[model samples]
Target: MSLPKSNLQKIIQVSCAIIVSEDRKILVTQRSASMSLPLKWEFPGGKIEKEESPEQTIVREIKEELNIEISMSNKLPSVTHHYENFSIILIPFICKIEHGEIKLSEHQAFRWLNPNKLLDLDWAEADIPVAQYYLQTLNK
Candidate 1:
């Protein structure tokens, strides 16, 4: 049987973000044409499946979307954003890719960028706040 309608509606979405740093630059992934917001940049992640915790979801999603294995530790402040089609409660986490290669499966492109250059690209609505907060914290 399928999930109950109200239960499904209450299902909160979670995502993992690895501000994978090298020389103080962070990694960003561009959503593919098939995604909800095509070409819009976001931290790499996907839906948190049933029976999985947010941390588990992040690890699984990173492997599925980026073809990389990540070790997530320490949760960042979560962000809640509403979209035209659906609302998402994104749990941002600080993670590091401990293994695997950079492979873009669901995204079209990827970039390593510093905070100063982050504003140059159009970010996904949900990710805009995260990027802004990241910059603010970096500047302090």
Candidate 2:
């Protein structure tokens, strides 16, 4: 059941990476079956820790989760989404890989999809708006 306003859970602050290649492909990862969202697709990232800026969160999370170092090129405004059990403020970053190769430790799969094709995959609830916002930015 969704949280009642009086008993709301803390809003988790998360940082996500929209890793773009020189050729304009964007990297996305599928949540492992054991993950909360199961096999849904999303831009890779994790929770922001204490004392971390959203940019710092992206770099650290990418290294730990995707095994790569990244440099942020731009940041989208944070999007807050409420799921049945919790809520999140998802901060999205537009970035490019600076080093290392990917060796997924937590995801079930990944894909480098062209921007226009992002909507083709089933996305996590929290990611739907971020993806839509990104696509809107592209058309402008």
Candidate 3:
């Protein structure tokens, strides 16, 4: 019932991004003190589980982490980053808020910043490229 050995070796991790905006500012979240990269700000998202599509993962992650619902849209470019412990292929989506006030369940704080100002903050290493793309494409 299982796939071949070649397929077994591949490890695919999934996550999502909620590109929330009001007027021109976008929401960004800070990783919690208990997290590995604590205090560094990141787009709110979490690990995608089995039996869910990327779109479903995005919705679930946002709700779980931010206590808000999002309308999943088209895919954004996937970014890959390697850390000392593990690497992740982050599939970020361009999403809009559907409902609920954002309540931080797993972070220190959240900010609504102009996309250009995104670069000014101390970002988690993995989020840098995604931030750059967001600023370049969405800020203007």
**Top lDDT prediction, candidate number:** 2
Return the clash pairs for model 1, or none: none
Cα lDDT tens digits for candidate 1, 90-125: 888877778888898889999988769887888888
lDDT of each: 0.80, 0.93, 0.79
> RMSD to the native, candidate 1?
4.2
In what order do the candidates fall by TM-score, top score first?
A: 2, 3, 1
Q: What is the per-residue lDDT of model 3 for residues 1-140, given as tens digits with 9 covering 90 to 100?
A: 98876444434566768475757587889988899898999888877788887778878889988898888666778888877667777888877888999888889999888766889999888888887876666546
TM-score of each: 0.85, 0.94, 0.86
TM-score of 3: 0.86
Model 2 agreement with the true structure over 14-120: per-residue lDDT tens digits: 99999999999999999999999899999999999999988888899999999999998889988999887789999999999999999999999999999999999
Candidate 3 lDDT (Cα, 0 to 1): 0.79
Between candidates 1 and 2, name the one with more favorable TM-score.
Answer: 2
Per-prediction backbone clash count: 0, 0, 0
In model 2, state the lDDT of residue 35.
97
RMSD of 3: 4.2
Q: Choose the strongest candidate by TM-score.
A: 2
Error of 2 at 71 (Å): 0.4
